[model samples]
Target chain A: MSFLSVQNIKHSYFTKSTAVAALSDISLEVKEGEFVSFLGPSGCGKTTLLSIISGLIEPTEGRVLLEGQPISLADAKIGYMLQQDYLFPWKTIEENILLGLKLSKRLTEQSKSASLNLLRQIGLIGVETQLPKQLSGGMRQRVALVRTLATEPKLLMLDEPFSALDYQTKLKLEDLISATLKQFNKTAILVTHDISEAISMSDRVLLFSPGPGRLHKVFDIPDVIKNLTPFEARNHELFPEIFQTIWKELESFETFKK
Target chain B: MKPSKNNADLLHKQYVHSLKREKRKVRLYQLLIFLLFFTSWEFSSKMKAIDPLLFSSPSKIIDLLFSKLHDGTLMENLSVTLIETIVGFILGTLLGTLLAAILWWSPMVSKVLDPYLVILNAMPKVALGPILIVGLGPGYASIISMGVIISIIITTIVVYTAFREVDSNFLKVLRIFGASRFQCFWEAILPASFPTIISTLKVNVGLSWVGVIVGEFLVSSKGLGYMITYGFQVFDFTLVWLALLVIAVFATVMYQIVAFIERKIVKE
Candidate 1:
């Protein structure tokens, strides 16, 4: 059985005048400890799929399973990070990081220390008492990552988490997240429009087509690139070859839509 | 590099000096306006340029204030009004916030009562003074109820809007942690709306004063509002002016206190 399985999911948003289908016939599976990327243009319902998999929204049709159980019943096992670091501005960094544990009623001495250790491991030391606004954007995003990991989720979702950061910060965070996820052996699915980001971080890149999004194509990374960090993977000789292949496919979708 | 550092330090000092100078200038202008208004009023009243009995000079108001203070009548009336206003203010804010919370808790209830809230907010609150006095028996109860009634609906609307306006993403974060609805409120919704709540408190201070004073006018038994009515009936405009000035001072003090609390609570 797959660690995470999305089986034939469909979703539609209804307004007073129209019912807009966001996703249709989407089915995929992730093996344990594998990193997958969902790459597509805007309106491809990448986020909609992520939201459904995370159990934040229910698909109009079909279901998601985690470890052979329904996703909704397996709450707190899924961690989702958004494009912006949506840390509570009112809360201190310590409170923000511990929020998940507190909400799950899993806040104990051992867990608290573990979370703080993760914070230190993420290179965000000595910022426990400071408010979110006091930190720079990069520091804040790192803190957000710590908050997500503090829950010790079995599956992680990154919805363009580094899209809002500068290029340098984005590259650094990509390496940090890839290494950390690998260390924990956690299954992760990253949704991104960035081709290089998909090529570098993912074991398999799932390209989605827009306009009632459907799974269009999948690319498997070679072992040479998969063994390297995201930064090194981006610089590998075969990186551009894979990038060109995916880029042309994505461009074809855009042209077909037009 | 050393010379540039010195230059930056010098520029910083000049900026601080200019800021202080601007603040001093503002204070000077405010003091000038106060002095000029009072001095002109006194001069005009003494010179009989304005009707002395109707306009009432600053001197006469002060003399009456002292005598009223000696007899303790001013304090008695002021205390009654202050207590009524304070009680009304607290109750109005609490009940309104509670109502807002209820509305936030259930979307159906808010939808059902939306039109009613709009109607209540638009209607003149003071127009209900006579009914409140008659129902609550022309006492502190009725007067305080007036203060509460006047501000409660608007506070409910403003606070409910604030609660709704909190970013849904914050709730999403909490929801992913398996947070209950109540947990979402306590953890995110309430704290996020503190600035709005504080601002509404500032507005409610003035609102409750209007309500209590109007209630007092209807009841006509005690309070600064009664003092104004009585002074008018007896042609004692000086007493009327005194009540107005006292109300003004107290209202400003209350507003300033709310602002101080806002500064302390909302760091950003």
Candidate 2:
């Protein structure tokens, strides 16, 4: 069985007068320690699908299974990073990072040390006492990632985590997240609009078409070598070929909608 | 090129000079206007243009303030009013915040109690003064009750709104991590709503002071409000003006304290 299975999930929103479908016929399985990117345009339900897989929202039809069992949000084993860092402005960096563990009542001396270690590993050592407002945007996003990772979740869902950042910061964070995910042996599903980002970091890029989004195509990178960084992937010889192909595919979707 | 650089330097210097002159002129104009008002008031009273009995001159008000200080009447009355204000402020804020948390914890309670809270907030608190005195019996209890009654409902409303307005996105982050409702509140809602809560405290500072003063006016043997009521009964307009000045100063000082705490919290 796949480490995480999303089976024929369909979700819709019902207003008092009408129903709006958000997602339909979404089925995929993520292998253990694999990095997958859900690449699509805005309003394509990329985030909705991520939310469903994270167990934050249940689909109207079908279900998600983690390790061949039904997943529950209350299990406390899914780390979902939102588009906004959502770092509590009132909390210090250290406090924010430890929030998950603290909420789960798993905060111990050992867990605290592990969180600090993660912070240091992510080059966020000195600002633990500083509040979220004091940090730069990129630094805040890094702290947010640390906060999610601190709890040692079995799966990580990154929902447009780097979208708020500038180009330079976004690339740097891509490297950081890609490296960190590997170092921790974490399986992750990243939802993003940026094609280069999707290509560089993901082991497989899942292209989603808009309007009640459904999976259109999936591209598995030719090689799955261990420790292949996003920067290295960008520099690969096949990078341009794959980039052009997906870029045209995405542009076609825009025209297709029009 | 060197000469243009020198010209740029000179232009910058001129700009700075003009800016400084403008700032100095503004400050001078403000000070002169304030001084002119006081001077005209004193001149008018001395020249008998306006009745000094009714509109006490700034100097006479100052003199009364000093005499009250020397006699310790101002100090004693000030302390009594301050204690009442502080007690009422603390109790009102704490109870209001707690009740707001309870209301937020259960949406049904919030919905059921919503209209009544609005009615209570809108009701003229002074109208409750006689009722409070009847129930609590004309002492610090009634006085503090007045303050709490005036401030608490507003606090509950403001805090509940803030709590509800806490970013749902942040709450989702906590929920995805398996955080319970209580954890979501403590970690996300409460912290996110902090600026609003502090703003509520600022509002409560004024409301609590007003409540205490109204209570004192209705039924109190001591306090600045009582002094004003007593001064009016004896036709001591100077005493009334002096008490008014003291209350204004005290309220401003209390407001500044709340603003300072707000600044510190926001800065952190």
* Colliding pairs, model 2: none
Candidate 2 has what TM-score? 0.91
Query: Which residue pairs does candidate 1 place in steric collision?
Result: none
- Evaluated at residue A56, the lDDT of candidate 2 is 81
TM-score of chain A in every predicted structure = 0.98, 0.96
**TM-score, candidate 1, chain B alone:** 0.97
What stretches of model 1 exceed 4 Å from their correct place? none
The weakest ten consecutive residues by lDDT in model 2 chain B span B184-193
Q: How close is candidate 1 to the true structure, as a TM-score?
A: 0.98
Model 2 C-alpha lDDT per residue in residues B1-268, reported as the tens digit of each score = 9999999999999999999999999999999999999899989998889998888888998999899999999999999999999899889988988999999999999999988998998988779899989999999999999988888888988888889888799889889878888888887778777888888888888999999999999999999999999999998888999999899999999999999999998776
Docking category of candidate 1: medium
lDDT on C-alpha atoms for all candidate structures: 0.93, 0.90
Chain B alone, candidate 2, TM-score of 0.91
